[model samples]
Target: MRIGLLTEGGYPYAAGEPGLWCERLVRGLGQHQFDLYAVGGSGIPRPLPPNARVARTADLGGSDSGPTARNLLERTAFGDRRAARRAYGRRERRRFVEALHRLAVGVCGEHTAGTGEAETGAELGIAFAEGLYALAELARERGGLPGALRSDDAVRTLESACRAPGARRGAAAAGLPDHLAFVEHLERTLRPLSLDWYAEDALGAADLCHAAAGGTTALPGLLAKRFFGTPLLVTEYGVQLRSHYLSAAGADRSAPLRTLLAALHGRLAAEVYGQAALLTPGNAHTRRWQEKCGADRARIRTVHPGMAADRFAEVGEDEESGDPATLVWVGRVEPAKDLIALLHAFAEIRALQPDARLRIVAVPVRDPGSGAYLAHIKGLAAQLFPDEAAGAHAVGENPVTFEELGGPEAPTLEDTYASGAVVVLSSVVEGFPTSLVEAMFCARATVSTDVGAVVEIIGGTGLVVPPRNPRALADACLALLREPERRHRLGAAARARALELFTVEQNLAAFRGIYLELLSHAPVRHRPGDGVPFAHPAEAHVPGSWAPKAAAGTGAPDA
Candidate 1:
């Protein structure tokens, strides 16, 4: 069976989040053909698996489509236009306006009648779905939705919807500029409507459309399902809506824009979840988010993100190694990781155990802001350990050492995890805690703040404390450091759990079954020359009682 693997800012790119996993899946299932549809990346060179090939790639991040002439006659033509397109008809224009209004109302907040009778949440959901499809259908027919969505009419419609009674206060207070900005952003976000991937020769030809992430990536699958009856299987290792929320929370945008974008994302997420044939959340933490966003519990499955466990196999098997008094933190150094709090906790740990050491093994994230955050963390470390040297030093000399992953002391990821007895995660905000899981794979006892899926991933195998609690974090690390036996036990348990649930093999197996399961239930779209049943069919040639019988004197099978 052919699978359309859809991705956004990931996959088929060496630096993408799901690149490794997608590559692994495609390589492992060599029997199946995979067509990759990627969006928003450098299109940087990356090797493709033998069974997989690129179908189409679009740069949603502002790549030019080149110049084209716009003829007035073609632009003025109606639905029968063969060149450009006509403005929406009176009826179609009203339908489009009404749909957008309904969607906006659903997004901002539901309204009640003068009698206090309000539309049900289900009704609002219907409105959002209807509005989304209406716009999509309009784009299909008019061929100018990109411009239409960015027009003054769309902005005015959105503003009016926000000003309507029962709209959320934040949205109701939006200014003209906010509306204009939002409309422009919305047009880009909804660009999947203008894509030509829905034809029978494209995504329509696939047995199933597997979205690597939700939000933007899943939009194409939604369109595919809408246009060609293709089933959509959405897999989200890190929930896209949640990431948007975090980024919006941190962004220097206006309140109105934030509120409007949040509402839009909420409505879109609900629609996607409602339409998906199945929703696979990488962890239970993400599953809860999906459930809250209206994904049916029956359709939700927890598929843990797979990691290559073999790289850490030797480290995990060596139970007696690692410094008993050292605490390690390994990950990208960013403010979200809350290294400041980690430094504070380490200060407390040092006071309790004079010989205890902390190794902050980290690498900067792609964002330039992380460099400043890393410097701040370094300054905090200096102030916390004022007696220690101000700069880098040989390993084991400084009580608190800051180093990158590829430094002489830690040449590889496995080596970095092996450098300490207790791995620590002190982030106040987290999603799946990939670093914690890596620690587990290294068979290292973890002392992590309870955030995101850390508790779920640890599964009682390691210590979990409340986020931003320095005393708790310090105490947990101290306990693990003081008691070697408990640390060893937790490490062994964590390793077992990681191997059982979070390995590449497990992930491949899950997707392998999911692909077959979705395909088994999907409606088969028969094409030309498929042949009639039992007429020169391969099944008829099988050695079974139902096989065609041979004539008494002839060697050939009777028809």
Candidate 2:
């Protein structure tokens, strides 16, 4: 079956996020065809992954515009249902306005779990948002609407509603400033609905549309289901809701602005989750976020992102000599990785195993975060070992080697893994920690901090330590370093587990089954003027069982 793989800022971009996984899936399942849809700027110049082939690529980076073209962005006047007058009624508008007021300006009503009622102002705000989207969709179908949906009238209506006498306590306190902030944010947030890609000609052809990520990537999926009857599957490796909340936690926007944006995103998540046929999260953490965003538990599945399994065969062989003393830290040099802690831990390691070498590999990116962190770590290394260095230790000659995985010394990622006795991921914050998994594929015992899905992914294959505890990290590394037999044993076990669960073969097999299962159950709906359908389209006129049997028996002249 054909799959419409939708993505944003990645996939088929030559340098897209989930680039390798997409390629792996495509290559692994050669029987199925894939169409890649990516949205990002045009700076991507990397070569495609070996397995990922695209029948066609739909780019959403830049738009071609002329003077007469509509900008697609317009003012939103909440309660302006003039464009879609009938979607909302008197009672809905009143309830929505009251709830929105409580949500925006007042203390949000209590969100009493399991009850559909909006006891808190927050719940009320979300209710009001539902009315707004409902009205917008109605307007799109009917070609116009006002009040809680779209238009200058809706904005005016929203302003009046928030300022209404019976509104929630906080909403009743809203001024022109609060009103304007909400309106400004509303315009920016609702930009997804204004795109033309939602039409029949764009997203209708696919048997199923699978969004590789959420947020903007899922926007087209929403449209496809709206304009066409296309089914949608939204998979998020990192919960977009959590990211938004973190990003907006300390913004300069007003309380109402924050509330409105939150409500809008909350409402969007709700809508996406509700509309999606399936919701796949990469880890349990992200899965919980999906549930909190109102995703039905039955519809949610945890599909760990696939990683390359073939690259590690050499080191993973039954007989390979990997150092028990040498520790490898591979990833872009960022503060989040807590390299300082790693250095301090390395100092502890040096006290016991004097010859133990700690290699800090950097993956080149345009950002100076890597270079700056490398320099800072180099300075710390100097401070740590003040006795050694002068003409003896230059940049390249230092014991704490600052090598790039995609550059000289360790030319490739696989080579870097092969060089290390053990892989160390000392990250304080991580989403999926792909490098750790890659190391696992190479049959290298890892020492990742107890962050993200490290503990879950490790599953007793490698040693894990708490974040920012250099001493504890040192102890764990020392334990593995001291026991060469244990390291080899753990490495073998980790390699076995990675191949069983995290490979492209397993991912492809699971998805291939799901695709067939979804299609088999879904009734085939043929678009008008699309030629003869494979399904039986002929009308029936049978009087009884005997008549039907008689008709079925004769194909020539009318019996």
Badly placed stretches (over 4 Å) of model 2 are: 27-35, 41-132, 135-188, 248-260, 368-370, 389-397, 535-559
Once fitted onto the true fold, the runs of candidate 1 whose alpha carbons sit more than 4 angstroms away are 62-98, 111-119, 248-250, 390-396, 529-559
For model 1, how does the per-residue alpha-carbon lDDT over 1-559 read when each residue is reduced to its tens digit?
A: 7799997575686464577778888898876879998866555648887778888787776411221112211222322232212466667667767777777777777545565443466676787788888888877776646456655456668988888887878898888667766765677788888787777778977878999889988998998899888999999888888988888233666798788888788888988998899999999889999999989999998999888889899999998778889898988888788888888898899888989998888864677777888889888887888766554543336688888878797789899888789999999888888888889999999998888988899998999999888899999999999999999999999999999999888988898788878877888665443233243331122433342343233454332
List per-candidate RMSD values in Å. 5.9, 7.9
Please give the lDDT score at residue 115 for candidate 2: 56
TM-scores for the candidates: 0.87, 0.76
**For residues 1-559, what per-residue lDDT tens digits would candidate 2 score against the true structure?**
4567786555666553476666666677655556666654244434544333443344444221211112222323223345434555676555444443433332222244555544553455455445545544644553433334334433555566666554544545556555555554554444445444454444666667888778767866777776676888988888776777766232655565455456556766777887899988888878878898778999988888876678778777843665556899888787888999999999999888877888888877777545777788889988886655454543333456777767778888778888878899998887788887888888888998998888878899999989999999999999888888899889888888888878777777777776776667566877654433432222222333554455457542331
Residue-pair clash count for candidate 2: 34
Query: Model 1 compared with the native: what TM-score?
Result: 0.87
